[model samples]
Target: MCVRYLGFVLLVWFTGVLRAQSAALHCGAPSLSGGYLVPEQETYSHESELTYACDNGRKPAVEGWWATSTCQNGKWSHEPQCIDEKACIPPTIPNAKYTEKLNGWYEEGHKIRITCDEGYEQKDQDATAECINGIWTSVPVCERSTQACGEPPKIPHAVIIHQEYQEVFAVDSELQYECEDGYTVEEADGKKSIFCIAGSWTKGPTCRIRPGTGLGGSTVGGTHGGHTTSTGSGTQPASGGGGIRPGTGLGGSTVGGTHGGHTTSTGSGTQPASGGGGTGPLTRHVSNCGKPPIVPNGEVLETNRLFLKYRCGTFYKLMGPETVVCYSDGTWSEVPTCRVAYCAVDTDEYPDLKHAGVKYIKDGESLRFECVDLWLVTNYSEGRCTDGRMTFTRCCNKFQLNTNIC
Candidate 1:
């Protein structure tokens, strides 16, 4: 160490001598922190160069951990500095500016708030970003005012009718909703539109079962919100649309009776309707959609004023819509077809086989078997089921003698 120090002193002395010869042309030693320079000297000649290295976990303020600086006309070409390697540089965001003071190098866990320029909007809830472990969190995006709202929120029992879903929506954009089978908007006459305003969507309607109807139109003796009254009893119309009439028969002809004046007591037709005993004209709801269309081999699982859900019978599968809707034009939606399905294997014909008992095997399914007795020839058999038919590949005899057959 002493030898190296003495050689460094000699080099400094020689540099001083050269500086004295051309005092105006020589450059003074450059200043550096958190690092050390090579060829330690008090002064350097014009056009002289030196390299610098930073301490551990630090790097030169320029490009890399080590850098070179040139002395020209008594000044260094680049200033040398050793900065923390974990320091974060400010991010550049288009159309956005930091609200707080920005530093050249920020230590870990630093935070900054940003604001969008005029005519632009922030895309995140909080317009702030934090630096952790030398890395900055995702910065909020600043988009034009036109792209203010994100994708529309989902509602219950309904789907937005969009050709393709989008991540963002422009202000004042409109979206429509289609209720699921057996459901309709609560407000039957109201529009089914949802609009994007500012950065949110307008309140949308709820999808509820249509009034005055049940699944498959099976519910009976129900009233239509007091709009109508039962027959044989003296009662005033709730809406004052009509008055009560006198009963001609002993029980005041069943409410909603046919024109012939014969009342059938089946009890299934006791639906909400306006009927009176007198000989006056009976008025029905002009917009009331009648019973749904019948589906062959398909029973109604759910029914409403304008919707019906049908389910296929056992061993039958539905090929089309399970639920049909009644449009405003008094037309019922297309009814689905019930096609026969071969989902089980028939074992009645194979009495001599080991699997004589009945067992259900779906189409395109199979079972494998081997000889039960080792004394008999080792034979394998497979029963493959397809379209209600099972193919028997081989059979083994239960007894090794003539009494047994395979």
Candidate 2:
């Protein structure tokens, strides 16, 4: 230990001595005072410096310790430093039921499951609790089952076997009722025709019966015959046979009594009963003999426009007034009124002279013409008129003959 100390002290002294010697050597430039003094006369000041470092959690170790000095100064006095220590730690969540099952720390990416207690059903799937930042997500609740049917139905003439029945009933269980013998049975729409299906009973049906006499044609009582009977008065008994008198002279009378009247017969007549005169043969007379011949009102002047009219006894066409039909008595039907058919005259200057006087040329009418001794006349031969327009073929007169006439 003493040798080490001696070495450190020697090193310090050597360094100081070198600096002092360097300070004493004023070689090239003159001093600001303009005095040519030896380097041994120069003076030097010590400098202070600092370095930075950090401890556990502190700030800078040193503050405000730095200086500049001449090269002849001793080693730096002291170095400054800083101390800093910082770290991050995780957060904690409280009262989380299933969070503990997630290893140890609940960090950003942790997950956990949540479920309802027994006898309770979850509306959705089991939820997952996520550790977002530091808090656990909310847990969902469970719900219970619901009832099916709405209300019990009403039944007529028959009473329900039990009151306040369950909302759901089992299948194939029948509902029975009793009605009077003469009445019929009926039911309501939905509930009345209800059949047992699946686990629950459909709505109950209503009961009814028709009101009338009983079956077997009896009127409320079981009697087959009645005691009251009808009788006739002053006339032959309706139950037995009898005869009719000869001179009764009833229209419907026969040797026996008339159908609706009583009869009386005696043994005193001497002359044989004169037979009634035989009914004469039925006869009919003829009058107003021989039908008269029908005379037409007038004769048709225009053959194309003639219309016929018939007499009273004559038969004619049942439809239009234009047609005439003969009667069964061999006579022509009366003639209807007649009118002239007038047509418009065509005045177009046709090139063909032969078709000049033709009036109202119908469809499909055609004509050809030739010039007489023409001096080479053109557009004169083939021509036609359709819909009041003239179409003519090209023609020219080739020669001249007689100057007076052809």
Candidate 3:
């Protein structure tokens, strides 16, 4: 299709003298399925169809691309092209093997058959995967079968208190165990035991104890204590329990972000984010975006909110907003970044472009493109340089090579 279009374009250019004659305007051939559709005769006159019947494995790249051309005055009505059936790479499936009779490449209409190995089952009932365009429509899955618990798990520093236990136990069996000296169950209502159930084992309790004291605590879960013993002037009552049971006098311990918002114990109930009728001031929840996202060649600004502002270095202008706000939900808004102010123009787009410009331009500067000779700007031939990004629009020989219009 491209060759035929180029041929017509070249013919029209060579027959420049015939432009004044009553010759039909040529149509640029468009790529169809994957084949070429040239006119039957050189006389591209009125109504005609550049026809070609594609093979079984091939189909049109786009819907209803076929069109008959009718020369309305001096131009052809439609572009000529055909669709090409491209092949798709085979998909990889875990624990599944493809059938031996697989083709080298799965064409558009081809199908791939996969079977799960022994002791494995398909994720879905569909065993056949189709190749649509360059991607596989869908792939089957195979996963290992799950079974009940094989043996009773042994606990560290503790033994099962229940007697009716065996090597291999049934599912959903709840066992009882107690922690030994210097150690105690941190979670599970302050009890030491694990339930025989899927998805819950991953969250099994840990034997925890307080630091410097026998009582233990796990810092993995929860935040400010929900129900506290008290709320002193310097201590803030925690709403999210940091551990299973509240330890003794957790005074001067700050919660949330590291902005000096400490919580104290004075035997009290829960406190809200704002004023909660307690002697302790409203604990400001600082935004902890984890190792604040760094902006290239930029410095962060000081702000009491969850987020910070970033500004580019000298000679560099900000590409986006400068301020990042820290929200009340213990999260920070998206951080703005800075980049180099150097911008480059793509000269390959304009075949007949002429300019005495360098490869890169300074920030906030515009490049001039001469609109003389065979080059035509049609009112535009300049581009601005900002944040290492260039927006250029240049026209050549009355044709738009590349432009950033609108």
Candidate 4:
């Protein structure tokens, strides 16, 4: 039989007939089984069925249509099996190494850790690793550890007190010094004792005081002149001196009118006996007369004739014949006169006086006036010098008497 349906051709024949017939079909080979015939059309035809078997120890394929042979009598064709096409697998990080790979079936946010060996230090990320493509992006590096000391101690003029003598130092441990005997020990600038924190001390010394001489007296006692002597004896000379005869003076000679012992004068003006050496007067002759004069009560001593004069709170030497007499009150009798002893007179004279008594002028001349104080002369500028017959003008304001005049 021959049937055409939807442009596809199907050949119908018995199973045995189809097996024995040698026919050529274009779309696909014809299938004959029992009374039914199934035609293999182009759309449904299996060209060359591939049998699928997973390699590399992959999961086995499922049995149904994907695994069952398709042809009825002829050799059944196997179907292609479903495979895992995912190329990305979680990247592995070696025990001590870190990975940055991101490829994996793991959900996002998966992480891993990486670390270094005992003496080594991790240079890269030591905490977390990320999943990326099938391979890790980067491997972490491990390096050797480094040892270092902190800043050196700030001590000056002092040495560290430790066996190591390292640059860094701790607190509470001290730095020592070597000072002279009399001087005291003290801390150096900008430094303190080391603690147990980070460093140790090395070596240090202490301060001592220096001996000296001071203005205060020495420990041993002596006089300011540094001399020591016994009673009735002079101080020993710094150099040796010859011994003198027992009762003799400086020259070892017999004294006085007697034959042997030294003699010293006891009277105010007497000299030592001639034959014995004697110390002469060491002072000059001074008279108390030239010193300030002592004034006795009711008596007057004229200082103008003497050498010294006394005034208010001061003593002065008399340079000329100015008289300064002493009074009963120990004060000078005369008021201090400011006038010079000698003076020359010119043609100009003093205003004329009209007093009847004698008028003495400072120039050592005297005249008799008929008028007294406040009286003016009638002759205007000149006046008669008579015994008692002088005429006068009336008193005026310009010729008024000066009450304070001495």
Candidate 2: Cα lDDT at 343: 22
For all predicted structures, in order, the TM-scores are 0.25, 0.15, 0.23, 0.14
Compose the digit string of candidate 1's lDDT tens values, residues 75-117.
7887666777776666777778985433356677888888776
Count steric clashes of candidate 1.
7
- Stretches > 4 Å off in candidate 3: 1-291, 296-298, 301-307, 312-321, 325-333, 337-343, 355-365, 370-381, 384-406
Estimate, for each residue in 1-406, the C-alpha lDDT of model 4 and write its tens digit: 2345523433334544665542221123323222112233332323433233444423222332223225423333432233232222344433355444432233234455676543344553244555443223454555532221243444343443444554432232344333333444432332233322112222122332333524232221111122212223322212112223455444322122123223232223223344533343221111211123222111124334322343221111223233444321123333332222222211123344331211212223222232224433332222332332333333333234223111
Residue-level lDDT of model 3, residues 1-406, one tens digit each, is 9999999999988788577454545433444454545455555543444554344655433333343545554454444434445656457787779953332345577788887654344564457888777567767776542322445566667777865655443334566777676766654145455444321221234444535674643322133425322344432334454532346444423343343333333435323332234442333323333234455445666654344667765434577777765432334566665555656554445554443222446688876564435432333366677766777555443234344442
Maximum-lDDT candidate: 1
Per-candidate RMSD, Å: 23.6, 48.0, 29.1, 51.5
Residue 227 lDDT in candidate 4: 22
Candidate 4's error at 182, in angstroms? 56
Off by over 4 Å in 1: 1-30, 38-51, 62-79, 99-103, 144-406
Q: Point out the higher-scoring one by TM-score: 2 or 3.
A: 3
